[model samples]
Target: MIKHLRGVWISCLLILGVGPSAGWAGVDSDISSSRYPSIQAALDANPGKVVEVAPGIHEIHDTIRIVTAGGGLVGSGRIIQMDPARPIVRIDHASGATLRGLTLTRPEGRRETESEAVIATDTHDLALVDLRVIDNQTRGAAIELRNCVDGQIRNCLVQNYQRVAVDDRTATPDQGFAFRCIIGTGILIRECQGTLIQGNRVREDRLVATPEVKRQHGLGQIIKKNAVRGRIASQRDWDRGETDNWMQGTAIHVGSPETTDNTQVIGNLVERAGQGFDIHADHVILSQNIVNDALVGMKAMHGSKHVIVTGNQFIKNTLWSIGMMPGASSLPSRAAQGGQPARAANVDGGSIIANNIITDFGLGQTRWIWGEENVGCPIRFDHGQVPENPPLVDVIIQGNLVYDTGRDTLIKEGKPEVVPPRYRYAVLVESGPSAPVGLHFSNNLFHPGVRGISNIELKP
Candidate 1:
């Protein structure tokens, strides 16, 4: 665990003649919404007490900043925005503070940058619990924790945050820079230590942010027992295209590069997303998670080290399930984007991929993605390409079950140019930078036969 951030402070303002928006209890320790004009007014009192909001719509002007510590912000009502461009709440430079039972909705037609509903940065000993951000406005992140330690987001439900909410449709999914920068995640933990994000649901809406960039290293964070599903769409999106657009969000994207270490992703169900667990960190563990119905299930992009992908299920994914490619090709700018990093960095250290269930659609699982060739396999490594990237290191693939794979695993016949499909391969390791430093394979199970697994230096 990293050290806690300390000695951080933000100045608070006391709006004198300008009273709180509503009623004010005008007391300390225990405050009520009707008693205060606005939620920010109660927080400004600095009584170190619980501020309870009534069951109604509380509109605010500025970002409600928390500069003091040791209090609670509890509301059974909704916090709407008078200024849609600004955030709803911000928790900073405070500890032992609790934000619970609140529903914050962003307004429509925000012309400014991406906006987050709740953000906690550089704080400790905080808890965000039982918050329902429902029918949320566009560009909504229920909670975003940055440089925060000893914080937890528990039992929260953030639903129906549209990806983009402007009048123009200039940016398509192909031009995904806006999505990468928007505050569209259910929860985003960046450059934090010892954080626990448990029992949260980020459902509906086909919009998200991908930190595939090389910043914000996360440490000692655990994302467990959460359900990140994109099976349903908004009424507006459903009218445009049904399942075609419903399953189009990235469930979880971890980007630390060298900063994030020893992070754990466990016991989560990610379904109907465009991508799942797109990771670019080191010493990460992805275990006991369910990844299904996506273009790419999981990936180690740009560059990574010491990743263990085990005890998981990759089922019915449209394209290659797991891939090891430079992330340069996956970001907003690619080789074609002039100066942008084309792929992720290089990979190093020993890794393990074991004891997982990887399934294919027998013969009918064929789709072209990102303008790539059609594929019906679970695992992929760059095969026999030129040696431009760094050499891949030691790998061990063992004790995994493969079902109905070979039908689309390989080319069927002799022409070699026009190839047909066959149920032949389960794993494909082709031209890498160089021969792997050490490669081992053992005890793999194939459902139909054993013809498709290829390119193993050391075989079972």
Candidate 2:
């Protein structure tokens, strides 16, 4: 294994640009340190060649912009961001650009930023492959793609990408609750069509929400100013608390402005996350993923439609395993600017949640942080944020399984102790004016929780 890994490292080094050693003596590169003083200088001189970064630590204070067509970067090198205000790399309108085999990170104090380590905007056929994004902590996403078409992020590892962020919802009257500090995301995709996120692993190593860690970071504090001035929305039953651990952040967050479509999130693993997959797009296919030790397994909401969630596993989740709901963006006003079809209509449902498995319910790392009244349901469907929006409609939940092993395997360094699963029901569906219409459940296998199976009928 060590030999194989060493060989891989060497191969990646060669791909990125190795030194003029005996083994790499005859290889020719488009641009290298021997040929150019710096990467920017090489790109400035040759705007269309791939900047071959040498296999070592390269620190930069300003963003490396890639704007020309066919301009790209490749190397198994480490690029450290020295300035907190600037991104490590930014690709704008660089069609057919490629960034691969790179390690992007920031130094100790330089980890915090509002910008991403890598941001791609208005790019088509952009490929980010075999990349390692580590410890680039931020209130924003570690890797963000905006308005890009036909992009793919594959075989990437994003570790410790979250920083504490203040989520202020004071401006919205419907979302009166706010968090003083919340975690940030790993990968964020917005308005990107035909994007494929595959074979990636997103995890948290250090910013765990242990009791002491929460106090040390001043997290989970109540925003009294926002709470007092604005009335908390009636649907926000989960926000009733003095202080939570601020376990809020998605491992992969896709879409929000209600323009992104045709996304596929497949074959990914998200461990120790606040939320595994937060989907807010249209025509999404979420399949063959594993979410372990998270607060939530996944959720599809906010005008999302035709989402197919299948063949996934959710383990050791403290909160609900799967959630589907509507948001403020799902209002009918989103379908039109002045009573005409302007963009894709804002609507929810016509989605299928099937063939998923949920195990070890309420056994997450932060399981102790939540109370029985609020957390732990294997499947949940909720209502819209505003009354004017259409209710979640025409959904099918089938062939899913939820089983409790009555033990917590997440507790390391000890014998697995027998603990009853902490959950209300196998499935929880809200009922009201905003209740989902034409809901169907069939062929599901579930172990009864505190409240047995579900509250609503499941026939047809």
Candidate 3:
């Protein structure tokens, strides 16, 4: 068979050494310039080397710092281009690095803000493969693993990041795994530790803003300075003000809770953000993702624990398609603070919001749970003046499918009614008899289009 395909292409060109001279094996011992000229002089001419950055566009003007220690930094199909005015690569305290098939661009008239294209601080076992962070005016985050530890960002292609597109801060928020990124925010896990955000393609560009009017003159009309406020300021009048600027941000922004237990956001394909996955961290696991045109589609906040939102696919989100805020004070339990465990009470008893598919387009405001109150005293409060109602004790919302293209989908407001009494189930809650557990909403599937009350009762 053609001599075994020429002996498997000569053993993959002798395991990719393809010698005819191309430099990179501990930095330039030979192999005359095709564009090496600096990547920190090819890592200071091979310090703990294992280089191989061949292939085209290597512009870079500064910040390619790789304080090596033990091999691995391959970009065999190079294109590190960055000068987005200037500010590319910067792996200061490196340790076992491995950057493959690069292509990090930046120069669209570089603005500033610590102008970053790459910056892995306090590094440790790193691995950024198949990269391609383009555009870059001042934040096309292709990769920025700070205080790194065993890291790994796969198949990248983070685009136009004006703000956050893979910024793993790493004090240990699950450690790493950002697969298939195409067009920004597809990943932003803060503190780091075994994190994994799979299959990405976040899209943003739709928030629509500019339209407001209010006038009431039934029993209230006293502003006669030239009287002419007959209230005629319309964008079709009232119900057309939710589209704010498409691509508003966040296709993934897991902030960190001390490595939030084996976190994982699977199968992504979000669109037009203002919100599309902003999980806070703690044993999280969101599956089969595919959100569209978001104003808000998934916003689980602080104290996140043992969360598991499954089988996703929320389309046309003008607003609200799963939102849980849990976290106001207890100070992580009272004192642990930033690292965790002062009062450390989240994970409100095993959460499992299952099988999803929401489609709200009535112009926003679908679901929201604020919960906040933990700072010191008060034990518990959900706005109704303590009478034996503690607050979200456990959760589980099953079988989903809500399409409210027009008739407002669900809202439960909360406030200073004195505090203490939280229960709002939507379905299946055969009597826990205490008065505050509402929000169980069984079987789901509600889309008859509007009249105000697919589920709502909030006045505290």
Top model number, TM-score:
2
Residues 378-414, model 2: lDDT tens digits: 8989887667768988999999999876743434457
Compared with the true structure, all predictions reach lDDT values of 0.57, 0.82, 0.49
RMSD of each: 15.0, 5.3, 22.0
Residue-level lDDT tens digits of model 1 in 78-174: 8876686677888887777788878877555552236777888788877887787654444434467777767777667766543533222223221
**Model 1 misplaced regions, further than 4 Å:** 1-30, 47-50, 107-113, 134-142, 161-184, 206-249, 325-349, 360-376, 382-389, 405-425, 434-439, 446-451, 454-460
Number of clashes recorded per candidate: 32, 1, 62
Give the TM-score (vs. native) of candidate 2.
Answer: 0.88
Worst ten in a row by lDDT for model 2: 19-28
In model 3, state the lDDT of residue 443. Answer: 60
Question: In candidate 3, what are the lDDT values of residues 190-265, reduced to their tens digit?
Answer: 6665656566564533222212100111111111111121122222212332112223356567766545456677
Candidate 3 or 1, higher TM-score: 1
lDDT of 3 at 258: 45
**Ranked candidates (lDDT, high to low):** 2, 1, 3
Question: For model 2, which pairs clash?
Answer: 16-75
